[model samples]
Structure formats: structure tokens, C-alpha cells
Target chain A: MKIDLENLTIKKAHEAMKNGGFSARELAQAYLNNIDKDLNAFIVVFDDVLEQADEADKRFKDGTAELLTGIPIAVKNNILIKGKKTTAGSKILENYKATYDATVIKRLKEKGVVFIGGTNLDEFAMGSSTENSAFGVTKNPHDKTRVPGGSSGGSAVAVASNYALVALGSETGGSIRQPASFCGVVGLKSTYGAVSRYGAAALGSSLDQISPLGKNIEDVEIVFDCIKGEDKMDSTSIPDKIYKEAEKDVNENKKIIGIPRHFLKEGIDKEVLENFENSVNKFKELGYKIKEIELPNIEYSLAIYYILMPSEASTNLARYDGMRFGFLKEGENLLGDYMKTKGEGFGKEVRRRIILGTYVLSAGYYDAYYNKAQVLRKMIRKEILKAFENVDAIITPTTPTPAFKIGERTKDPVQMYLADIFTVPANITNIPAISIPSGFVNMDGKELPLGLQIMTPHMQEKLLFKISREVLS
Target chain B: MEIKDIENLAKLSRIELSDDEKKELLGEMDSILGFVEQIQKVETGENVSEAGDLVNVMRSDEDTHESGVFTDDILAEVPKVENGFVKVKKIL
Candidate 1:
């Protein structure tokens, strides 16, 4: 029977697999055939993809198939999949393979999900655009000339362009959601510790979360449910009680959406702002109250994120010494070996963050920069938590603008970082936030997507999904 | 940051940068640090998060074997290995 990979979702695909509409191998092949190699979304399309599909088919035949069974999912390169090449888009580990699967990967495998391939990302998940990838950039499917917002740009494109039914992307700040917004898909950044980070490459450990980007919120929720839970390996992973507390009925009268009017003050593109305003009115028309609120310390989020992210990143990345694993280069001396191997292997953005991280953590400046950022981080979290007291969720534009032309903001790293202004606060507060497609805006005759970001209190993913479904509808 | 500071950081980070990279990085460092310098304005006097809630997590001490798919395949891809040990430059 004919299969339409373009219109397939995990839930739809599951029903088809159960009814034997087509074999999992056939569905996998449909995706493989539809993959546009020029998009450069995938790092490695597993050679044994059909073999995994066949295994998933066996589960369906045996009546053991689950929601994700037989559904091919793409993973961002940073997350480990046992024995597969996991580059994290850096040249340092270009030839390196995972010794063990990430907790999320293991969970999906147990559910009989088929592994499609690993997708490209910003090297070490550092940059806003996938331009930092040591391999070539993954072009935006909407307009090939523009960037597919990143560091999970490839994962976003994989699902956006129908390369995979759904894909996994990790978030340090806005890695997952921003890309999803740019690619016109749904991205969910789960609350920190909601999912185990056992085998994913560490970036900003305090701010990092494994997120899912899908064609819709329902598909993302299905993937998120499979992966989220506490694990012995990740002590920071939250207990299941948090999920229980979050599973509450949607309250229309209690659904007050908070908008920080200050964030929309300047630099946001005109059309993007219009799209956000439209979403606000749509929610208002749907009986959801729109309240204008103030988050006092939010202005300092970008600065705080910059300081904290690099400080944590530099410390976390110290493990990549050339001696043990990754690409190695012989030098005149031991120190020289470290210098040459790292200098040659790491991309520019990674190096920048490392140096910046080292400086902030260095003597004399530590108290002023690192310590102050920590205080501000807590303040930002408290402010967001306080805002949730009166409002069920907070709303903002996912990016200041849609996907900009490639090389537009690369030269100036600060401007590139500004693209994540609205999205970074949720990562700071460890809140569950999602970017769902609001509508599209025309840019130079091309229609680019815009996203309305909804942030709820920590462990309140149910409200986030409830509100996101309303917004998308 | 100055060129001398960049040199010190490069040494600390153990990454060699060419002359051009050093100059380029020096300018970028100045701008980035200047940008993040805004955090100093935050008024965080005496209102820190409670310390008790921030204690380090410790699991019970026990001898347990780890069993997974990990194997010698990871070692096979290393640049240099000898007698099941990764080979590195002389330290002393």
C-alpha cells in the first residue's frame, strides 16, 4: 500500500502499523526516499535502518507495538546511541562513537521505536545557528538561503522537511524551540531534570534539557512521555511525583496568559510582532484572559545566561582531552598536544565560549561575574515563579524574528545570541516551555514561520501542552 | 581583555591560536566581556538562596557491577593504544 510520509504523525503512523497498512520497512523507506540530501540535515543515516524497522515490525506483528513502535525518529548528534557516531557537530569527536546509549535512547529502544539517524547541530550545542557545525550547515527547508534556527537546526529540519516523523533535540538555552519555530514545527523544552541527561553531551548542565521537536504538540508529548523519568545515572532527574502534580484538568477561568510587554518593546521585526499580537487576541477570543505582567529581572537574563552558560560549559567540556577519546594530534610536548588537538578540533564558537568561561571562572573576576550571575539566575527564576502566581502561563515571541539569512548575524556573536532573548528565561527558571507555530509571515516573497512561546511554572508541562494545543488550534 | 590576557587564557585553556586568531579573539573578548558586564548592576545583597536546599546529593555506598553494551569497540577507535591503555605523551 502507498504511504504518505509527509502527512504521517506518530499517532497516525501507529494506527497504520497496527492495521498492517504498510510494513515499517516501507514507511522507513518512504522517509529515506523523501530525504533531501542537499538539506544536509543528517550526519549519518544508519546503514541498518531497515533492520531496525524490521525489528519494529516484529513488535507490531506480535501485538506488542506501542505508540512509538515502528515510527522512525531522528536524534540530534549530541545524544549517544550505542556504537553510533555521535559528533555533537564538532570535529573533535568526528570519528568517535558512543559506548552506551543515552537514557532516552534506551527508553525508546525498549518501546520498539526505529532509529533513523543522527542530525547536525551547533558544535557542542553552543551557537544559535547550526553554522558553528564543523560539518556543513543544515539549510532551512523554508528558504534554503536562511538558517534553520539552532543549535538543533538539523533536528528541526529533519521533521520540518519530512525526513523523520519526529526528532529529538537537546536544549541548553533555546536550541530546540528556536529551531522548531524557524522550521514551522512544535518544540518542547521540558523542565530541567524532567528527563535524564545520562548519556547526552553536557553543555550548560544546570540549564540543559533533552527536548523533542515534532510536527505537532501531540507527537511531541508522546515522545516526551516515553523519555521522561528519574534515573540512577542522572541524580538531578526529578521524581515521578512532579509529573503527577502537573497532571491537572485544564481550567478556562484559571487560564490567564501573562505577557511581559517590555520584551516586545524594540528590535522585534514588525510582522513577527503582528503574529504574536494575533495569537494574544486569538487566546482572548477563546476565553483565555491576557494579563500584562512584569518580570523585573528578565532584562538581565541574556547577560546572566551568557556568564552562567560559558562558565558551566568550560567546566563540563574539560573532559575532551586528546589522550582518551576524540581526534588527537601529536605535538612537541604534553601541553602542546593538548593545545594543538583542542585548538584544531574545536570550532570558533566553542573556543570563544571556552575562553570566556575560563575568564569568568578565573581569579578576581569570579566574584563579580560568576557569583553575580548566579544571584541573578535565582532572581530571574523567582520572578518567573512569582508571575505564575497570578497567571497560568507566560507568552512571548519565540525569536525576535524568524530565521535570518545565513551569515546575517554570524560575524557578531552578541547579535546572534540576542535571537534567543525570549526563550532563555525558561531555561534559567527550569520551567516547561514550548514554541508552537502561530502563523507565517512573508520575508522577501518567501513565507517564514513565527512561533508563540508559552512558559509555565516548573513541572507544569500539562498546562503548557494544554495552552499550546489551544494556541495551535 | 588585552592580548597578554588572551595569551594567558589560551595557555590555561590549552588551545594554541595563531597570531591572527589571537588578535581577532582579543577584540571579540573585549566586546563579549563588555556585554556580559551588565550583570554587575544586579542588586543581590544578602538575599541569596537558602543553603540547605542546595546540598550535594549522595547515594548509598555499595559495590555494584555496571552492565551495558559498552565494549572494546570504543577503544579500537582511539588514536594510540597499548596493552588496553590509551597511549599519551611523556609527562615527566
Candidate 2:
């Protein structure tokens, strides 16, 4: 039997596979047939796809199948799977192979899920566009001239183009949700520490969160359930009990969504803002109250993210000293070896961030840039908490504009960072936020997808899912 | 920030950027630093130090001592390993 793979959720795949409608191998092959290699979405397509599918099929026959059993999922290249090349889209680690499965991979493997491949991302998950990837840019499925959004651009594109049923993307300040917005798919930036970061390369330790991108919110939640839990390897991973408490406390009767009107005043594309307004009206039509609230520190989010992310990223990336693993280049001396290997191995954007991070973290500038940003981070969190007191969640356009041309903002680093303005607040405040396809905007006779972003207080994913469903449906 | 500042940072960061790259970095850093200067006006209360609510999580210092767990697999991925140790350029 044939089916629409674009709308096929994990639950539907399970039923189809159980009834012998199609073999897992057939599903896997069907996806492989539709892939366009020029899109450059995947870094590596595992050769053992059929073997993994056969294992999942055995789980079904043995009645040990879980939700993701026999399902083909695409993961960002940063998440490690044992015996696979996890490049993090950088040449430095291009030859490196994982010795152990990341915590998320370990969990998924136990449930008999089939990993189709690792998708392309911005090198070390540093940039807002996939153009920074050493491999190539992942063109948006809607328009080849436009980017898929990044550093999780490939995962978003994979789900948007129906190359994978659902994909896992990691966000270091809007990497997942922004791309999901641009590509016109559903992406969730799981609350900081809500998912394990044990196996993922650290971009910003305080801000990075592994997330899910899917065709819809329900599909995203299904993957979230399979992957969300505390791990011994990640000390920051939150307990299921914290998430459950918020889930149980959700008040279905009085659901008030907050809109920070101050943020919408300037710098947003006209069509994107119109689409955002239409989404707000849709929420109102669904029996939810909408309120305008004040988040005074909202404007500082972008500046704060640049400072904090790079500071942490510099510290995290210091491990790639061309010593134990990854790329190496001998020089005249030890310092020269270190400088030459790094200068050659890393891409342009990665080098810029490393220098920027080092600059901010240096002794004299630390108080001015890094420490101040941390204090403002707390202020942003407090402001969000205050806003939540009056509303169940906050709504905004996921991106100021949708899917700009690949090279549009590459020249200006600050302009590129501005693409993440609306989504970075949730990352700073450690809140669960989801980017659901709001509608489409016409650009030069082509329909580009726009996303409505909803951010709820910490561990409040249930509210995000409920509101996203109301808006999406 | 100037080209000299960029050079200092490049040296500190252990990245051997070319002179052209250093000039480009100086201009970029100048603009970025100018943009982030607005954050200085925020009046954080006295004695606000920690970035977030996170604290160091301590675990007992005892090793369970599982033998032959992942030593071989890890060593296999290292670029240069000699006598079960990862080889690196001499520090001195």
C-alpha cells in the first residue's frame, strides 16, 4: 500500500508495519528514492540502513517494539552514534568516529529505531545559516536560492522535504526553531537541560539544547517523549518529574497567550508580521485569550546571546587542540602546531567566534561583556517569569524574516545573529519553545513557509504543544 | 578594537590568522563590540555573580573500575597513539 510520507507520523508507521502493509525496508528505501543529492542535506547516509531496519522488524515480530521502532529518523551530525563518523560539519573532526553512542542515541537504539543518516549543520553549530558547513549549503526545499536556516538546517530540510519521517536537531540559540521556521516545518527547542547533551558537541554549554523537528507538533512530541530524560552522563539533564509537574499543572480552562508588542514594533518583515497576526487571531478563535505583556529586557536578548554563547563556546572548543583526536598539522614548535592546526582545520565563522569568545573572556573585558551578559540573562529570565505570571505562554514570529537568500546576511555577523532575535529569549530563560508552521508568505511568486513561535515557562512543553495544535490545526 | 587588538586575541586564542584576516576581524570586532555596549546600562543588583541557577554537582570520587570498557575503541580513533598513550607535540 502507498501512503503520503510527508504526513506519516510514527504512530501511523507502526500500524502500517505491524499489519504488513509495507516492510520497514520498503519504507527506508522509499525515503532514499526521493532524496535529491544536490540538496546536500546529509553528511553521511549510513550503509547499514537495511540491516538496522531488519533489526527493527525483528523487534516488531518479537513484540518488543517501542514508539520509534522500525522508524527511520535523521539526526544532526553533532550527535554521536558509535562506529559512525560524527563530523559536527567541521573538517577538524571529519575523520573522527564515535567510540560510544550518545545518551540519546543509546536510548533510541535500545528502542530499535533506525538512524537513516546524520544531517548537515553549520560547522560546530556556530552559524545561523547552513552556508558555514564545510560540506555545502542545504538549499531550502521551497526555493533552491534560499537557505534552509541553520545550524540545524539539514534536519529541518530533511523533514520539510520528506527525506525523513522526523529529524533531531540541536539548538544553541535558535538553531533548530529558526531553521524549522525558514523551512516551514515544526521544530521544538526543548527546555535547556530537558534533554541530554552528553553526546552532542558543546556549542554553548549554558544555552544549547537538543531538539526535534517534525512535520507537525504531534510528531515532534512523539520524538520528544522517546528522547527526553535525565542521564547520568549529563549533569544538567532535568528529571522527568520536573516536566511531569508542569504537565499536570496545565490549566486548560484559562489559557492566556502573551504577545510582547514592543518586539513587534520594528525590524520585522511586513508579510511575516501579517502572518503572525493571523496566527494570534486563530488562537483567539480557538477560545484562548490573548494579552499584550511587557518584557523590558527583550531587546537585549540578541546582544546577550552573542556574548554568552561565544564565551562558553570558546571554552568548550578549546579541547580541539590537534592532539588526541581530529585534524593535525605539525609546525615549527608546539604553539605553532596548535595555531596552524586550528587556523587550517576550522572554517571562517568558527575562527571568528573563537576569537570573539577569547576576547570577551579575557581578564579586563570579562566584567564588561561576559559578566554583564550573565546578569542580563538572569534579568531576561526574571522578566519571562514575570510575563508568565499573567499568561500561559508567549507568542512571536520565529524569525524576523523567512529564509533570506543564502549569502544575504553572511557579510555582517551581527545581521546574521539578528535572525535569531525572537527565539533566543527562550534559550536564555531555559523555557520550552516550539516553532509550528503558521502559514505561507508569497515571495517572488514562490510560497515560503512562515512559523509561529510559542514559548512557555520552564518545563511547560504541554502548553506549547496544546497551543501549537490549536494554531496549526 | 584595532588590528593590534585582533592580533593579540588571535595569539591568545592560538589561531594563526593572516594579516588580511586580522584586518577583517578588527573591523568586525569593532562593530560587534559597539553593538553590545548597550548592555552596560543594566543595573544588576549587588552581589549577582552566578550566570544561572546551576551549581556544581558533586559525585563520590570512587571508581567502579570496569575493566576493558572503551579503552581500545577510544584509542583506535586517536590520530597518534604510542604505547596506549595519545601522542602529542612536546610541551617544552
Candidate 3:
């Protein structure tokens, strides 16, 4: 059997490099080889893979390697890749190259991290499944027929399929974690603004966080440490403050893990609930106290998120007119060209969201929809603040169900939106959430991964890691 | 709620939906809007929803910020360009 990097954590990969077993080029090439044929996971697998691999290999040989020097990483397309076509999986930007290295990409490059390629995502990180991508749908490696949970679908799938050892995935809601859970990999979405969003294709600016998807939690942590720092490029980035309270050893502690009793009330699949309970039981086995807690405003998160997220998406996506950087329509008038480019270029889901966003943010309904959601958005934040005060970290299912059949929910917008229900609460709160794979679905005897979303207080990422490591191990 | 509402919304969103699509969406969006309306019933307080807590994040007016480097070439690749500016279709 080929040596699967899925079994090799980042720490182990670093050790192998230290031992001279495989050079970084060989490691990166191995992943490239694995993604052969119908992996169907990448929008455009980097053409510059060999070049980056060679650079990483040289750095490894010179002994000037950072912790993740040799580990090949995929960056989500929405995040800037300098000259690469950073489409965010929308046709309008099918040719628009980024002007500057997004703050995260710049930092990672400085640390000797070789960016293998940009992974696909929902247009502007707007949807639950990668199907919303205008380029194409990214298939789950575990099961090709099912949808890879998105909008960070390509990022999670890249790591899961061992195409890249780690990938940077941005989450507005569970774009990173939900997809990571479905792909059976570890994904971390740091606190809102914890990672810089300087060059990412904006979704909900309030909720956007550029996080990491890795083969394991250790790999995720390594990438996080390298990229998680303030940058002048991102005005929203927070100054690094080592929170003392998070330094407490949580290996065997019996701290409160809040379970939002209302979160799983509706549309939860049987297998997901079973897997989630099994995960909680494992945490209990690890001696962590599980408390049935009430996040009262959690139910409204979906309603609030669809309104607020789309509102921001509308404004952010307005920059993608055909005339400037993207695929311009061949027409006479400006409005005609704009209409043709967007009408043909955008996918059904992206158009739907833009419409929803524009409707809510429009003059008459702005207060009724967008402004009301914002007021309730703070209420959701307050609910999390209150809940976290009572409990150290909150535990919930990352998504309602595991990977569904590719076309199962596509026809129904409500069903499609429901996939984001459990994940949207975290976006509402701007808290740190990590989805570590929690066993499998026993129903079909197929391995469908469940995401156990562990949310901690803002910037308490160390504590999130501590609990996540304990639970995952 | 009405075809007119969907039409109005479509115009606001800048997407041109056909009459048939508008008719279908008006019925569907009625339910979606009905669902959102329930949240307005929940008690909330005056809170300005801001993206981040960081305030006064303005750059200094000093000349030291720019190092006269523009190698990324983002502007050069624009599909329509003219004299260091991204050119767009003619505006009325």
C-alpha cells in the first residue's frame, strides 16, 4: 500500500523530513500522484506544483525549514494566490488574478510553506455544498457520488484525499469545519478575525475566518501557529495576546462542555445524532463533564445568517462586473454586458443568494430583513457570551447530516440552506470552532464522518485545541 | 408575497428574472420570508452590529508605508485596462 499521509500527522511529517526518509519534493509529488485521474477534488490542481515542491525540498536540505516547511498545502481559491485566478468558483472572476498576496498566504510563504494550488469553493463562500461553485462540484473522496460539504469543500477534500498535507480554509459559518467533518479530516476555524482576511473573497465579513484543514489536529495546529498573527494588511486582525486562562492543562479535567439542546431539534439525520452522541460519550470517557445547556437564540441563527450573510455577499460580489478583471460579456451597452456576464457566468445558487442579499439590504426591506438580522445577530452573540460564561466550551454537531447524495437537496433551496443550520450559529457568535472527525455512520455501513463542533470563548484557541486533542485522541 | 414583490426584489438584487421564474420565486420566497418574519418577534436590544472590535484602524499619512513595489501585476492582467486603471464598459 502507498504510504498515506492521512495517517501521518504534521508532527510526524516534520520528523520524517528530519530523518531524511523523504524530501519535501517527494512528499509533495506523492500527494500529486495520489490526486491522479477522477479525484474530481480540485478546480485547477496547481500547474506550479513541481516548482513549489523543488523550493520546499531545497529549504529542507538547507536546514532552514520552518515547522511546516516540507508539508505541501492547498489554499482555498477564495484566498488570494497572488497571480493565480482567484475565482472563488464564480465565472465572472474566472480570469481575475489577485493583485497582492493575501495576508495569510504571505505569512505562510515566509515560513517556507509551499502553496500547492488553490482549491474550489462556493462562489464567495456562500453555499453549504460545493455544488454552488460555478466551475464545478468537488466530489468527496470517501464517496464520489456524495457532495463534499462546502463552501470550503475543496480545501477539506484536498487534505482528506492526501492531495495536500494541509490546506487553508476560510469559514464564514462551517465552511471549513462542516466540510472537514464530512471529508473525515480535522478543520479549525479560529475566532472571527483571528486569522487575517486581507485578500479573501469576502462572504460575511463579520463571520469570515481563514483557518486550516489538516490530516490531523497537530497538522492544523502547526499551520495555525505559522499564520495566526496580526497583519497591517487586514484592518480587522486582532493583536496576538496569549490568554493565560487557556494555558490550563485540560487533558483530564472535568470542565463543562455545553450542548445546545435546541440545535439538534429539527432535520437531524439519525446517523449524525448517533455519531455525535458517541463523540460526546468519548469525551465523557476522557473525563470531561458534559452539560445540557441552552443556547436559546440558536434556532434563529439560520434565519439571521441567511439574511445577513447574503446581504454582505451581495455587496462583496458587486465588484465582479464583467468589464474589469473577470469574464466580460461581448455586448454593446454596459448594463447589457453586466447582465449577460452575471446571468450566464453565475451558478443558480450564487444568483439566488445575491438576489436574497440584495432583497434584504434594499431600501424598503433593509430594516425588516438586514437590520433586524443584525440586531438579532448581536443577540446571538450575547447568547454565546452567556453560554460560554457558564461553560468553558460548547459542543454541538457541525452539520445536520453527513455527505448527502450530490443532487439530493439541490432542487430545494430550504433543504440546501438547512445543511448550514448547525454551523451558522458559530458564525453568528464569532467564536472559535473546530470539527474533528467523530467516528462513522452505522446505518449504511459506510464511513460518513460527523463533525463535533467545539466552540470556545473568543481567542481561547489553545483551550479549543486542548479539548479537541483530548476528544480526538 | 406577490409577483410584484419578487419583481421588485429581482430589480434590487440586479438579476433579471423572467416572468415565469419570478412567478415561481414569488410563491417560494413568500414562505422563506415568512420564516424570517418569526425572528423579528424575538426581543432584541440596540446594538450596532460591527465586524470587529478594533477601532481607529487607519493607516498613518506618512510617506514610509509605500516601498515603490508593484510586482504582483494584478492590474496588468485586467481584461480591460487603460493607463494604470482597470477599464470597464462605458457608464451613462
Give the per-prediction TM-score of chain B: 0.75, 0.77, 0.59
Please provide, for model 1 over A163-241, each residue's C-alpha lDDT reduced to its tens digit, 9 standing for 90 to 100. Answer: 8899999998999999999999999999999999989999999999997999988999999999999887898999787
Tens-digit lDDT string for candidate 3 (A1-473): 35567688777777777788777777877888888436556777778877886787788788788787767889899888777878888887877788879888888888777777888888778777888887788888777888889889998888888888899988887889889988988889897777889988887787899999986777788888888887777777876554334434333353788898766778888878887888888878877788888877779988998888878888887776765567776556777777777767776777777777777877888878887888888877887898877788998888888899888987777788888787778778888888888877743556777788888888878888888888877
Give residue A71's error in model 1 in angstroms.
0.6
Cα error, candidate 3, residue A466 (Å)? 0.6
Clashing pairs in 1: none
CAPRI grade, predicted model 3? medium
Better of 1 and 3 by lDDT: 1
Shift of residue A168 alpha carbon in model 1, Å = 0.3
- Model 2 lDDT tens row, A1-473: 56679778988998988888887888888887778998999999999988999988888788888778888899999999999999999999989898888888988888888898999999999988899998889999899999999999999989888888999999989999999999999999988888999999999999889988999888899888878988867888887777687778877765898999998887999999999989988988898899999999889998999999988988898898888788988888889989998999999999999999999999999988888888888888989999899998899999999899989999999899989999899898889999989889999888999998999888878778987887777
After superposing candidate 3 on the true structure, give the runs of residues whose Cα lies further than 4 Å from its correct spot. Answer: A242-254, A443-445, B45-54, B61-72, B82-85
Per-residue lDDT of candidate 3, residues B1-92 (tens digit): 57787777666655666677777676667666776777888877565646656568886667463553762375566677777777766687
lDDT (CA) per prediction: 0.90, 0.89, 0.79
Question: How far is A34's C-alpha from truth in model 3 (Å)?
Answer: 0.3
Q: Which pairs of residues collide in model 2?
A: none
Clashes of 2: 0
Per candidate, native contacts kept equal 0.72, 0.68, 0.56
